[model samples]
Target: MGAKMLAEAMGMKALLYANWERLELAEVPEPQPKTGEVLIRVGHVGICGSELECVVQRHPRRKPPLIMGHEFAGTVVALGEGVANLSVGQKVAVNPFVVCHTCRWCRLGKSNICERRQLMSMHRPGAFAEFVAVPAENCHPLPDHADTRLGAMVEPVANAVHAVRLTGQVLPKRVVVFGAGPIGLVCAQVAKAMGAGFVVVVEIAPERLAVARQFADAVINPAETDFLTEVQALTDGEGFDLALDAVGRSQTRRMAVDAVHPTGVAVWVGLHDDETSLSGMGIVYGEKRVQGSYAYTDDDFAMALQLVVGGRVEVASWVQEFPLDEGVEVFWQLARGEARHIVKALLRP
Candidate 1:
């Protein structure tokens, strides 16, 4: 059925990106599922850091008059034609990246980099609303006993899994994570779950650092201490086997490369900044490998869900929840950095 046909039947509240640097709780016609799609009734949706950056900076790709949410958990309220695998009332965590299966990257099992990829918030209406339509294949079913909020966390955890998996390290002895944001914290936990001997987290925010201490073997505040010296001391001057930078600044990027031992790997996952200058000779002489990680593949997503469901990673304690009606205030508070205590925020619709 067409959306226009359903316009009079349903009206739902959504946090709309009505304009640049503005969010409004507006009632709009709920979306209708198309062929091969499923209409979900949103349960919990996370406010991604990237969404805050896009809204505050007015990113070109994420144009306004859009509903911007991707990390979400919901129930299958209705199924479109040709979608027979899912049924009404089934709980699920969604993979928001819609890719063209015929692309070369997709064929190589790297659909995260597909040439023609469409993201939920950027390319179409997202789960910030009461209802969203997504491809049936994008939904990963959750266990009957699982908390719906945990389903909302699967996306960010998948990001950490993808970043750590990209390093190709088997049971790294020591790992260092820059930034104690949601991604970095999860990376530390994932490294430990994958058998890293020790994990260190570096963050300037004291609130975030305090939370980091819960998961990391050691937490460092660069503003109050010598970061490189402390890192070297922790590794007995040998440096870490792997370093992951969840902060995309030039300094953190360089530090990630420097914090790893010779021939070690450095993975960059954050997107705070675009351009950075590094010492070419240093990377060459050290033989250090640097890789960039984007979103997760299907396998990574499934693995992440397993890790979360199996209780290998922590989620509930660090996440804060608010009503969907308060999304505007919550978004602005997060954008202004007022809610340091909240590692993650979810809007309950």
Candidate 2:
């Protein structure tokens, strides 16, 4: 305890987003848990695809000179005043969205879209350091059998959980997911977990498609063949019961709109493109439903944790772990698409 306390008094190593395309590895003062917050000793922090936008100064909410990690898991080191549920040394995964409970959206049970939502990396310092402070209510206890590496995946899995839940009353029997990236793969898996009968993944990258084939019933490479023809052949021209756009490209969005059956649903989970054109009459005449899913609700987060802790979801196959000091180079590699073989990267502090 004395040594741990001494280490806390001394500065800890942290990777700081100093500027666009710039990250600095420096020793910074240790963070203390404020009221209703818990100080966690970070075990692992996964890099998000959206963080690339933050690094390039494109994300609207995230600014520079920040600690940019949100998908993370750790052990509770200290509990702040007024926090009683968590204890020291309890392993937990974090839900990074800190919302204002007073907002109308929050009051309506849609806190994921809270008007005053403050994400950990975007609004406050995050877990790219040895320690991070988060609201005690955001922590979910992981089972003893669960690895912290897999625990770090709970957040992204929760994203998929929320996206699939947005389909509204229709549980997809035949589903097509556009893109085989991290989110896309997880979306397919969660759809299967949620009882989708058939799931197909579409991707241009052979490596990613091969990985997606592990979880999906089928995989299609759109670069070599016609995706629409293949999808039509699979469903006998009925179109998919559900279509999800996990790659936020104009082409993928269009594919989603075209692939879903009449009166079916299309969910847009990716945010790559801000503006896309869809046929107005096509939507009206076909009675197709399109919805956008952002982050996850508290119940979704809890269910995600349960999935990981219960060994129902597996992420160890596609994740690559690196030291926290190597985050800058890893971030650049991910941004440049150099690490195409791996699905996601984790920074271990």
Candidate 3:
């Protein structure tokens, strides 16, 4: 708090470019913590789709020249003035989305959706660098027995937890999820843990379909058959009690809507390119419900962490790791729909 602590390591390179393409490596700077902030020595940082989006085009919020990554697991290395109950070398998982708590959404117990919320990589410098400064209160200390990778994933897992938990109040009902990506796959597992009698996941890719099959009651490949037909067949033509769209495509979003039973809930968690056409009358006869879910609550993060730590859900099995330098290749492949076997990718700094 007295002075900016600059890392004096001569020529120690950290993040080259906040945008990966330039490969513009920058000199490592010792992070300075403002009041109530902590400088975390990041252990692991995951490359996410949001980071890819920022890199792929003109990011509306990105100021660039900053490191890119939101998911991070670290040890508290330094604390700002007035920080308490925390010590150096404390292992913790950061809630990177720093929210302006004075907002309306924050007051409604939805701070994750706060209008002024600036997610780590987008608004603040992120974990793509060696260290990141975040609010001390945003971190949750890791359990002694938890895998450190699980800590880095708490952020993304929170999204999956929110998407699944918002479906309905029902228990022990059939559920179908579209696109077995990380979120979709995780949502499938969460739904089952929340008492879905049978959780089905649909993926067009053979590799992803196989991965989903490992944890889901049924995995349907739309490449070989009509997805809507397959979903109907699995749900016995009554459609699933709940349907979740994780791919974010117009067709898949509609698929999630169409796959739900009469009066069932359809949760849209996907972000897609095109606006989809849906039948208004289609939902009228069924009394189906559709809604979009964003970010997550602290409770969702806690539940997702517990599931991973308790061995009730296996995230490690679906994970793939990539070094920071491989950022460009990874994003290109992911953008082109490559990396079929991978549900999640970890970017190590």
lDDT of each: 0.92, 0.88, 0.78
Q: Count the backbone clashes (under 3 Å) in each candidate.
A: 0, 0, 4
- TM-scores, each model vs. reference: 0.97, 0.96, 0.92
Question: How many angstroms is residue 221 displaced in model 2 relative to the true structure, after the best TM-score fit?
Answer: 1.2
- Residues 1-349, model 2: lDDT tens digits: 6976975687888988887678888888899889999999999999999997667755657778888899999999999999999999899999999999889999998999999898999999988999998999999998887767988999999999899888865677999999988889888988888889999999988889888989999888888988889988989889998988899988899889888988988899999888999997889999998888899998899988887677566688888999998988888888887888668999999
Best by TM-score: 1
lDDT of 1 by residue, 113-178 (tens): 999999999998898989999999999999998877999999999999999888775757999999
Worst 10 residues of 1 by lDDT: 1-10
Candidate 3 lands at a TM-score of 0.92
All candidates in order of TM-score, best leading: 1, 2, 3
Best candidate per lDDT, number? 1
Candidate 3 per-residue C-alpha lDDT over 1-349 given as tens digits, one digit per residue, 9 for 90 to 100? 2333224332234554444444354666666779999988777777777666655664667666766678888889899998997888898888887888789988888887989888787777788766788899888888888755878887777788888778656653888888887788788888878788898888887778888898799888777888778876887788888888888888888888888888988888877654877888989998989988988977787787777777767788888877766755775677566776566888765
What local lDDT does model 3 show for residue 125?
77
| Ranked candidates, highest lDDT first | 1, 2, 3
Pick out the ten consecutive residues of candidate 2 with the lowest summed lDDT: 53-62
Error of 3 at 83 (Å): 1.3
